[model samples]
Target: MLVVLVHLLFYSCVLSKVYKLQLTHKAKHIHQHKHHKRQNSASLINAQDFDFYVNVTVGNGQVFSLIVDTGSSDMFVRGPGCVSNSGDNSCECDNMLPNPTACVLNTFDSSLSNLSQTAYVQYGSANVNFNIFSGPVLFDGFQITNFPFGSAYQISGLGNSGDGILGLGFNSISRVAWATGKDASIFDALGLTGRQQIFGTYLSNFDFQHFVNDVVGGEITIGGIDNTKFTGPITYVPLISESYWKFNISTLTFSFGGSQPLYLGSSGGGNAISDTGTGQIYLDNSLADRVNSFLGGVYSNVYGSYVVDCKWQNSKIPMIFTLYGVKYSLSSSSYIIPYNGVCLSGISRNGADGHTAFSNFGQVWGRSYYTIYDKFNGRIGFAKAV
Candidate 1:
C-alpha cells in the first residue's frame, strides 16, 4: 500500500518569550460541548524536536521512511550509490535520539522499479538523479496512480537527512511535476471520496514525565479531522494564498502572569505559513529581537540563535498568536529547548540559512495546536489539542 507518514521533528527550533503567570486565583477549566467529530486521522512519532517521519510504501511495495514536510512541495529519495554528509548524526543513528535505530533507514532501488525516463531535481540542500517510476502509491485504503515520482540512483545532501522527504506541499511548486510535465505529487493524484481534501497534523514532543512517547501521541491525519486527537472548537482561518499553508497574522501576544495579554505589535500586518518540514519558528528581525529582549537572552553566533538562561523555562505560559479573530498558542516548554545546560530559543530572526522570508510557524507552533489543512476550502484549522 502507499503509506505516507509525516514525522514532525522535535527539531531544535520554535521559541517563545518567558512569562510568569500571576499566582492570583488558579486557572480553571470550564467544560463545553463544542466538538469537531471528524474521524479520519493517523499517528505521528516525534523525538523531542529531533525528527518526525513515517513508513511510506511506494511503487512496487518499496517502503521508505520519509520526513513529512509541508514547507516545500516535492519528493525525492536516496537509492544506489547514495552518500551521506559528514557529522550528520541522522545517518549514524545516535543513541541520544528517541529511535535507537535512527540510522537503520531505507533507500529506493531505481534499477528494480518500473521506469519511464531519467530526471533531475534540485531542492533545498538536495541534488538528485532519479527515474520516473510508473506504478501505484498506496496508503491505508487509498490508492494513487498516474502521478509519478523519482526512484533516485545517485543522490547527495539528502539520504543523510532522512530515509527521504515526502513533500506535503502544493503542486504549483513541485519540482518533479514541473520537470516531467505531469502530475507527480500524491496530494494531487489521490482520488478521494467527494471533494474532501483535508489534512490534519497532531505533533508532540518527548515529555520527560512520559519518556516513551506521550500517552496522547502525534500523527498526520488525512481525509478529515480526528475528533479523538483534539478537544473543543477548532479555530479556522482562510488561506490568504494558495502557494503554501499561508495565513495572515492578527497579533502576537504575551503577558505577565494573568495580566492583560500584551501585544508584540511587530507582526501587525505580517503573514505566516505553517511549515511541517522546518523545526524553527522564524519572524522578522524586529519581532525576534523584541521577543528576545523581553526574554532577556543574547544572540550566539556559534549556535546561530539566542541563548537564554534555562531558568526561564519555569516562568512561562503559552504565547498567543491571533489569526483572523481566533487565537492559537505555543508554550514556553516547547520553545525553551534545553541543551548543554542552557536553553536555546526556537523563535529566531528570518534570513538565517534554510529559512523563509515571512514569518514561518514550524513544528514548534504545531506542537501546541492540532493543525488541520482544509485543502478543498482553502483554509487552515487550529484546534487546541487535549
Candidate 2:
C-alpha cells in the first residue's frame, strides 16, 4: 500500500518584513461599509469556462480586464512590447473582446506615470511568461491609491482569459517582490484600509452548452461577505499556510445516491490550495488516477488531462472534501465541464512526484461555496452559495 501524503513544500515558509501601508477610514464610514454597502464589490466576467476576469479601471481611464486571483499576490496588466514566448507572432490573448480595448500587448503606457524597477514572473509548468515594471496603480473607486503594481509589456502564454492577473493573496511570499526587488502592494493596501480584513469570491454558474466570452459571471467583494451570495451562515477555519491560502483537507470521498461513501484512498490528510486561478480540482497522481478510473475517466496525452464520460454529468455523484473536519461537497454539475463537443473532467493530477498529496480546491470548490479569504485573523470562511 503506497499511500502518498499530500505535501506542498515548494512554498517558502519564511515571512518577510513588509512596510505596512494603512488607509485610515473613520469609524462611522467603516460601519456603513460593513452594514450598508458590503464594500468594494465588482462583477466577475467568465472567460469561457476557463477562469473569471474582472474589468479594472487603471491609469487615465484605461480599462483593463484582470483575472481576479486569490492564489497569487501581485497585479500586472498587458503593456507595450508584449509578445508570445515563441516569438513576436502571437500576443497570447483573446480575439478582441468588445469592452476591453486592448486584447493584446502594447496596451500599458509607462510614460503616463512614474515607472521604475523591472518585474518578471515565469510559470514554468503553465508556460506563461511575464515581464513587468512597478508603478503607482489607480483604481476606479474605493480609493485604493499608491498601490505598487506590475505593468507587463512583455508576456506569453497568458491564455484567453484577461489582460493580466489581479492577485489577492497575502504579500508575505509575493513572487513579484522576488522579481522586482520591491514591495508588492494591493492586498497589503486593502488590509491597512481600516475595514474588514476579508475578501470574498463568488464565481457564478453559466450555460454549459452555450458558454462564451464576455458574459456576466459573478462578483468579488472586498472587506466583507455579501450575505446574498451564500446561504446560512459562514463557517470559518484557520489557515494552515498563509502564503497561498492553503488549508489541510482531511479526506476526499466519492459518494453517490445516499450510498456509503467510498474513500479515494488519500490518507494522512493533504494540504489543498484554495486558488481562484486554477480551474480544476487537483489531486495527487495516485489519488487522481484512482478517482478518475473509478469515475470511468481516461487520461489523454494530447490534452494532458483526464476525460470522463459525458454521461457522468448526470451521475448524481458528489466528491466530498473533508476540510478541518467539515465536509464540503461538490456535485457532478460543478466538476464536469462540457468543452468542444466533449466533456472534460474538472479534476486533474497535480503533476507532482509520488508520496506527496498537495491537492488544490480549485474554482469548482468555489462554485459550491462562497469563499472568504480572511487575512486579519488568518482564516478561510466557507458558506454554501445560493
Candidate 3:
C-alpha cells in the first residue's frame, strides 16, 4: 500500500515520543513529592510535660508507674514475682524500704564485673527485672555512672499505668533488649565529662488526663530535646537505619468522607510504625471495620478512647502519609480525638489480635498522634497537631 503507509507513520512517531517522556517524568515526580513533604514538615518537635524525668535507681518509694520510653534504653525496677492490685501479692518490698536515710542496697554484685550479669524481661505486662548498676546515679542533679538498668524482676501489679521504662531509645551500643548488664549508659558516662552529649526521654508519670501526679519524674535528654520544656517549633522524625530501633512510616492512608477508607504502603509496598507504646490507632480489622462503618459505627474501647460523630460535614477528610517520598496531609484534627468540646472519633478496629500478631501487612499508625522522633541536623522530622 505505499510501503504500508510509511510503516504506519513511523510507528506513530515513536509512540508519541514515548508518551511525552512518560508525562514529563510523572510531572516531575509529583513536584518532587510535594517538595519533600514541605521540607519534612519543618523538623517537628513540640515536646513537654515538664521536659521529663524518671531516673529512679532501684525502687524508690511506694509509688510507681513510669513510662517515658523511646523504645528501650535502661532504668529498671519491678522485682519479686509481681502480680499486684492488692490481691495477688508480691510487690511492696521497695527492695526492703526503711525511711529515706538515703535508702541503699540496690545490689547486682555479679562479682564486681568482668562483664555479664544478665536476666532481662519486658513488654507491657510489665514484670520487670534486668540489671547492671554502677552508680552515683542521681538524675535531677545530673549524676550517672555505669548505670545500665531495668528491675521489677517479676512484680506484676503495677500492670496498668507505669512503674519503670525510660530508655529514651536510640541503641546506645548495648544493654537493651530490655537491658540486663555490661553496665555503661547515660550516654556512656558523657565521655568522662568532656561532655559528649546528653538528652533522651519519654516523660509522663501522668498527665494528659492519665493523672498520677507528684509528677513522678520523666526525662531523656542526650544531645537534645529540652527547649525550656516545650512551647513550639520542634517537629523532627528521622531514625530507622542504624540497623534498627524502629520508625519507618512512609505510608498508611485512611480517609472517610473523601473516600479511601484505608490504604497501606500505597502502590509500591508497605511500612507504618510510630509506636510510642501504641495506646491506639491500629487499623486493618478489615480496614478497621471499614473505617468504623464509614464513621457512623462510633467507637470507644477506652485505651486512649475514640468516639466519632462530627457528621462528616464538608467531607474530604484525609490521612495520606508517605515518609521517604514525604507527604503528610492528615487533616480532621490529625485524626480527631476531642472530648467535652465534642468531636470524638479517632478510628479503631479493636486491634484484631494486635494486628494479627504484628503485621503480616495490615495497618497501624497508632499512638493516635504525637509522633515526633527528632534526631537533629542530619534529618528526621514528622510534625502534627498545633
Best lDDT among the predictions, by candidate number: 2
lDDT of 1: 0.56
Error of model 1, residue 101, in angstroms: 9.2
Provide the lowest-lDDT 10-residue window in model 3: 26-35
lDDT of 1 at 246: 82
- Models ranked on lDDT: 2, 1, 3
**Which tens-of-lDDT digit does each residue in 39-121 have in candidate 1?**
23445545445445554556556655555677666665545444445642223322232232223223343423444677665
- Across 226-342, the per-residue lDDT of candidate 2 in tens digits comes to 678899878887788768787766555655446566564363245666777766777777777776765788877645567788998888778775554567778888888766566
Relative to the true structure, how large is the alpha-carbon lDDT of every model? Answer: 0.56, 0.58, 0.34
* Model 1 root-mean-square deviation: 10.6
Question: Model 2 reaches what TM-score against the true structure?
Answer: 0.79
For all candidates, the clash counts are 19, 5, 55
Error of 2 at 104 (Å): 5.4
lDDT, model 1, position 4: 15
